[model samples]
Target: MITQQRKLVTELPGPISKSLAQRRVAAVSSAVSGGSDIYVAGAEGAILLDVDGNQIIDFGSGIGVTSVGHSDPRVVAAVTEQAASFGHTCFMVNPYENYIELCEKIAEVTPGDFDKRSVLLNSGAEAVENAVKIARAYTGRQAVVVFDHAYHGRTNLTMAMTAKVSPYKDGFGPFAPEIYRVGMAYPYRWPTGPENCAEEAFADFVGQVHIQVGEQHVAAVVLEPIQGEGGFIVPAPGFLAKLVEWCHANGVVFIADEVQSGFCRTGAWFAVEHEGIVPDLITTAKALGGGLPIAAVTGRAEIMNAPVPGGLGGTFGGNPLSCAAALAAIETMEAEDLPGKARRIGEVLSARLTALATQFPQIGEVRGRGAMMAIEIIVPDGSKAPDAALTKAVVAACIRRGVAMLSCGSFGNVIRMLPPLVSDISLIEDAMDVLAEAFAEVLG
Candidate 1:
């Protein structure tokens, strides 16, 4: 189903999508961000057929969800089979085997063998909120420490933990209190270079957290192994493990928000594995259900058991259909050796971007792991001036040329990539060629 595409046919929004947007505006909530033009109709592998009949390469993977690609045969079959058999029974009320089976699988794959446990949820944000809840329940502490440039979720508690303020927390205030914000080990934007040593940077950031929040009152310290939406920025080497050690020493649980970087997106099941560090809790979503809404909060058995029986249950929290899809997705990942494939994809993608950087002056920084990647666009040489206009132009150019691109960052200046791990290698190379042309059109 990896068909080739070559034409835009109409404007990026096209007349059809614009009309749909008109109707959508009348019905949908305005609070939701994004455009109607980019709406998708069908997807398979790396290509998306939009409402306008335009076939676009899906570089964002629905914000990093469809790892095996949209509508994979196995996932579709599993969903259909489960939906036909039984849809809902509510885990807290009736329970089921799939949930238990999925939990066992997650425990097997997740880092840290010390009797890990997991609980399924509806979305990444919910898992994150639950992780903090478990940490608080276990440690009997009130304060939780978060880092700058970290994005956990949009839920009330998660919003408080999130770093950016503009859209995610603009009007919503009085976020859950006792939450403290600390600096991160972001190397690209750091005053020091990659050689500055992330171990040293993390040590400094941890010291600042204890000085400000006081370790005695802290429940947990949450962070992203690779900051997603905060620019696909990866923390420097030794940073993650060192921070976990610091938290453990201070009796603070360490939470890894791997919702966007988990699975095979980082060439590993979890980005934390890159440093051989096991998180006290790991929140995962996006690619877990193959496209369906599903998430999980996995952690050490003791911490997972901290919460009371009735404390964690959702009406739709482990929807059977999603569980089935997740089962299939997990199977597909292993069968396809996606972790190895993901690492190869990163090698190719990073190489292409590195070459593009040499030819174009606009691509400021190329950073990320596996298929999850990005390029920070700046105004000029060595300047941090966010080039939102330039970034928008690049995306527009790509859409016009039948290629879909997505921009993210607090300033909307970073062009992030999240192509499906199952995408055709040649198609990725083709997209790279188109991107090179788009860069010329926008930056020249």
Candidate 2:
């Protein structure tokens, strides 16, 4: 509970954590890996307390799942009250009021003023899978289009939809069929340069959809407005709007996969709102449940109702406890205006990272919006080659210094920061200070 500031009572992964790591190796699955060796005993705000009494600054936010902060009191109270009353009745069999209320809240918060309906699920991938199903059912098509360097989820269909291959999709295939991949307007690594990225990428996407995958046969075009697992790649201006326009013309559902970019993480209700575009369907999860497992697919009622009464849902979909936590999280976000908070966090991240980039040529580019930001690491050579080794070293240095950071990207050369929105200016500055020291130690 004492997490207002950072403290290091012991070295990283001291005795307690080491023992736990050994126990974990014996008990837990090998597939479940962690960013650090330190075992969390407790967490609050932006600080994670290790079992050895080391208080580390949290910059990852459990991979963007705790935007409201770890163990938020309001969320805890709501979940506790709901759990004491009753944990699960299986909403599909015996519907609950909290589930319905959560759906209403999601409809109000997500984009599009049109009549919308929602189906709650357990994770981002489930939400996306359901969205694809709905789109296909409604459009009477089978092709689902995704962009390069995109990371949807770990499910079979989502793995097929994802672009990265190493850990996510290496030996997992043969994946689902009829999934089309297109080039994203990645501004930093555009072959022709940032100036021509939007138009060229758009043209290429149109050509691919037409020539390779017929636009008429496509069910949905799904993309993250600001690519999350793709090194926080913010596409060139107007890229997403053009895609939305094309989807409209072709009758393809434009699905915004806001699992990581939604819930005030991008300084807006959803990242797509930054461009004033309304997606026909939106898939959201991560922070939506306030550290609980809950995801939802919200969209126009006509599209959402494409599936029959028993066609969509899981045994645990929209569990009462997760619904309570989601409702409380939404209330906290609205009451505190967390979107404004996220904008301020973005300003801090931009200022700190921009200054760091000026100091280190290895910092290829600093990009992202609001609490979700990242720095792509590259070799100092003019070719701008990704330096995955150097990125790993930098992240290791940060962890050794009691700051938890994350590495992501197709090539593993990007350091992303997803600090909790509730972290105050002082805590954020402290985390950035540690980051600055880490960069100086690694890049200098």
Candidate 3:
């Protein structure tokens, strides 16, 4: 097994990785962007072994996909065992026990005491699309409401629901209709102030739905408890609960897109649990599959069953191998108490990042829950203007120094950290040290 440590044997994207990059430029579409040119050979725990014989610390967790750690033994073993028996046998055509078992596990963990049902899918986008479909079917409404800075997916309907435009929805015009965008209770950038963000934003959101979309015409109100690609933006306290309450009262299906905040990434099974809100439908992916391609929309039985037979499902929705991996991942989460581990990681991140902010005025704010944390970069000119260039420089500096980092936000000025739950505290501390060095080098 590769040692779990950061060791740069050669420059990042060394000979082999450079060669792979050249080949990729020739074969792969330029449309598929990546964080770095460093090609990965293998990964274990919180370390990634690059093709150039470098072990880089992983703080992104494959964009929050491998929460149980890369190549977790349990997930690998389960997938291997299941693949040996059967790989595909469309659940809709020929049902399987593992599929049912995984759904049962999802229900037990997902926040809700009411009986729930689930429909497995292949990706987060697919799950979001299906969630909207189910909500429309149940409510008999045409409009779907989403918040600003929210990222749902890349599908036509999802792209319409998503807020970003540059890469996700740019030029992909003529999107699905009946999608309405509303303001989010972003405490960091709220116009009035952070203190009034929750109540004011909630009021604006409700008023917009009432005037623009009309309450009765809305099918669902979809949101990420902690916005993902939208900079890990954690909505103000009471904002989520108010929205859920309004959704229930107005007969709008509340869909929580927990793709990035689900599993143990947020110190809870789902970020909504932090707000004590039970969504009518919850779309999950990313970490749920333990690196496999699987997503699900689990929610109330009445709403889920509204869709008639043959209304939901895809050819590879619940592949036996993916189901096996999910079951093992859930088992690992429970047995290891990864939620508590995430809380500890959050403590370390909050402390280190908060302290760093004191040294670098460019770091405007530090916020997040559990391992899902971020720092918004701003110009030190006292105006708090976004500093995308500085953000990019800091991330590049960290990558060159062997700590893999990722940045995201509406203005691309937020540095987000999502280290694996199994990462050693010492390893995380080392990564933070590298981050501080990168910030100092860039700012100085």
Best by lDDT: 3
**Model 1 accuracy (lDDT, Cα):** 0.86
The order of the candidates by lDDT, greatest first, is 3, 2, 1
Candidate 1: list runs displaced more than 4 Å.
1-7
* Colliding pairs, model 3: none
Candidate 2 — number of clashing residue pairs?
Answer: 0
| Model 2, runs deviating above 4 Å | none
lDDT against the true structure, per candidate, is 0.86, 0.92, 0.94
Model 2's alpha-carbon lDDT is 0.92
Write model 2 residue lDDT over 1-444, tens digit each, in one string: 665788887777789998988898899998876668899989988889889888888889988999999888899999999989999999988888999999999999998899999999999999999999999999999999999999999999999999999889988899999999999999999999999999999999999999999988999999999888878889899999999999999999999999999999989989999999999999999999999999999999999999877899999999999999999999989998999999999999999999989988899899999999999999988999999999999899888888889999988999999999998888888888888888788767
- Span of 10 residues, lowest total lDDT, candidate 3: 4-13
When summed lDDT is taken over every stretch of 10 residues in candidate 2, the lowest stretch is 1-10
Order of candidates by TM-score, top first?
Answer: 3, 2, 1
Model 1 per-residue lDDT tens digits across residues 28-74: 89888853266677878778887887778888888999998888889
RMSD to the native, candidate 1?
Answer: 1.5
